[model samples]
Target chain A: MRKGGVVVRDVDSEVLQEVVVLRFLRNLFRRKDTVEYLREAWRTKPSIAVAEKLFHRLQDTGSPGAALAFIREAGRAYPHAQRLRDLQHQALRVRSSEEVKSLRAALAANPRPEIYARLGELYRYLGHCEEALEIAREGIARYPQSGGNYLAIGLVHYSRFLKTSSAHDGLQTEACLRQAYALDSASFKSLYYLACLYVYAGAKPMASECIARLAELMPGDNRVADLAQRAQALPDSPQGTAADYFRLHEARAMEAAAGAPGRAEPFAGLRPGKPLNDRLARIAALPGVDGVCVLDRYGARIAGAGRSGDTACNEAALQGMLEGARVNARRMSIGNFSRAVLRSKDWQVFLYELEPYGLAVMGGRTARQDLVQRKVTEFIEECLCEEQGA
Target chain B: MKRILKELNRTAGIRGSMVMTQDGIMVAAALGPDLVEDVVAALASALLTTVKRSFNQIAAGESLSELVLTATDGKMVFLDLGNAYLVVVAKRDLALASTMVEIQSAAHRIKNRRASTVQRQTAAAR
Candidate 1:
């Protein structure tokens, strides 16, 4: 049987028939805003499952960027909602191919502020600085109040500054970053970049200010700690004034640009469809592997995959143990605690500190701990290199 | 304690500060009305206790000078003061090093004052 000229074999038996009806009406009336309003209504309700389903539908209809925007709107009502936060992270970790296709399609079909910003980020990540800047400008033009677009523009300019050592570019980057921070003080990206730019500019006080804000935004972040250390290391007195420093920096930038050499694209070997979690899952699938996880400096699991019965308990234990090691290291004046390996007759456990994050691997006694460690290091290097390369 | 905390708050980004006993009692605080000083004290005390235990178990030595906890909304720094702890709440962008230095100085003053008062009480008893 058919209703409203659409096949409906079990419309009455559907779980969210209202969604189906809404979609039908939306299609019939060709009114996108009506459906968006309904989606907003659904968001106000505390239904994670429905929200997840609608999120998937939104992704299917639009793109990950669109899905991100929808979830961001939903997030206002449920600020501390964990699932929504996880979904947002998932959207950000989009497979490259899928992201590119969807972003292009989304922009072509119906461009929105988030799509433009995200696309600009992807371009920046891929080292297409010119394209990234163009997209950022378009995004700014479309969404004047959007701090993220400004951040993207700032990042692009910062990257150029790194390449050419241009004082003008550095100033532009700083201004854009400051604007971004002014608009949205809560964002870690803007604050982090501002701190970094300040440090490079030898503005210790300003750098310290940015670092403090970043620490609050992402507590226990190693990057913030590193910036803090750098700020502390700056001398109380400098030889030159601000103008003189910029002039010197410009001279150096010109010299470096004149000797420009070919370099590989950032994220050179990072193919689409393989995120850090997927990579960990692959490692877990190796023979004799019991469990593997990626953790932050604080020992909180960023992602993990395992066959072990007590994965959560093991991770928690490791976290506590790592904290103990760090404390001991600090007391002993032994510098940073990099790695710890525990081997017993039954199993072997390995923990490595990948700055800003940690990698924990555990397996049976007969397992290839060496190979696992190598793989972990390689994966970590790839991520770091991607970040630095960009 | 109020005077010290108020002075600390004069520095930009310092939200508030409090003094709490090791047993989780709130001695004094300069926090805002929206914040429950007692609850913060209790949580800080509990966290410090956990840190101490972790240190003991690891044999990392006895002197646990301070604790810093970073969260999304704010940062908390707990300075150990023998019988009590000083908890400082500040925004993410606050100058942490200088603030820590200021707190340590204030903590020293509190300890000395308490020590002198204890000595006077002992003399009176004699």
Candidate 2:
């Protein structure tokens, strides 16, 4: 989902499934009477799953502090429930929207000046600029000399200015960036963000000046270079906007759907399609065939045919290819990655990066995984060496 | 996953290896015995979002392919594997460049295989 002009996709469901499963079974076993019955069954011959069942239950009840004390008890041995709780909680909670809520309470507690500074950050993350300002104000009022407090206020104003399009808001944004600059002359983070604000807000020269100063402050940092590259490369129209990436996404989705067994049985000699499926038909008839496809960056359809089981339905496979190109060159100590191969349950993807983008091949036949790899590599090299080959 | 952890710990000088989704799910992880998966997943998700925000702020785009954190104890490297992330924590005593190279190569292999599978399926559908 896109919010505040930024697209945020839903969390992967597979991991959620596991957590849900844990919760479900925990519920089944935690009934007051059953806990006693199972506690005895677990004594004679304790099972790992059963032990874990009781262990996870304690976490939800927040009785981990006491449960852990019994971890050394034999049979239905309790787990280091508290430790598990701490680890699980840390892994899950930090980035959640709840951070904003907790920080609200943290603000109410007024625990310490540091607490307020942190709470101010939480408010900004939740996009609660007004709340952030109020929190920062109180902190600053308590400690006017604290640079972090000033920085927090600056962030809220700058954030609001960016979100709102009115002329009034624009002025407000400028005022905030200025206040931020005056209050924290030594903070490059404030200066750098101000530079971005300037660039997006149409103050290019001022943006450049701010960037130059930021660069001076952190000469070793590559962030400025990275930002400059991306900004300059921005696409011009909807055709080129991030949405255009779906061309490739659709092609991939199609391939996966075709591979679905419910769609069609495998054709011995020919797959059904105007033409694209013919090449796939021939390959399918070959022994040990599962599924197949060819693709390029941007998720466009190129050609071919297959079973949904044989195809890759997961969009992450596309991302994996792009990442492969990056890691191959960086980690392999190789000067470049002309082609690469990826293997997983029931499928394989072979990708060859070309100028601007690249081509990819997917199939489920793992009988000769190496051959597929070689073919992809050769095809890529041929295309590059002689355009006529493609 | 065990083999991967062993390899990183040995050849790549990784102190730990974790597999997590961009949206705060822990798919797999091998950390210190004291650590727990849910905790790792949660903390990593928070950290991942923070990094992604940084990437967006810098105009480097919406995704973060990798991130490296250096501390007194060692180095931690994050590899963006599309929907999932591979996190490698290296001992401070290890050389940064060498370990990074090893982890990078491994990540490449994993991504390439995944892409090939997707491409094959895409082709059949067309």
What residue runs in model 1 are displaced by over 4 Å at the alpha carbon? A1-149, A152-318, A321-390, B61-63
Top candidate, metric TM-score: 1
- Provide the lDDT at B94 for model 1: 55
Provide the DockQ value for model 1.
0.01
Candidate 2, which segments miss by more than 4 Å at Cα? A1-113, A230-390, B1-126
Give lDDT: candidate 1, residue A73: 66
Docking quality band of candidate 1, CAPRI definitions: incorrect
**Chain A TM per candidate, in order of listing:** 0.42, 0.35
Chain B TM-score, candidates in order: 0.88, 0.79
The sequence of per-residue lDDT tens digits that candidate 2 reaches over residues B33-116 is 645667656655665564355334322243555555433234556788887888766554455555667887767766776699
Query: Residue by residue across A122-161, what tens digits does model 2's lDDT show?
Result: 6664444455777878887897666566667766665444
| Model 1 agreement with the true structure over B1-126: per-residue lDDT tens digits | 678777877777777888898888988899866567877776666656655554333222344555555432456667777788887777654556577678788788777777898899999999
Report the C-alpha lDDT of model 1 over A63-179, residue by residue, as the tens digit.
677787777766665666645655554455454436767898999999888888888888776544556777889999989888988999998888655544557777888889889
Which candidate comes out best when scored by lDDT? 1
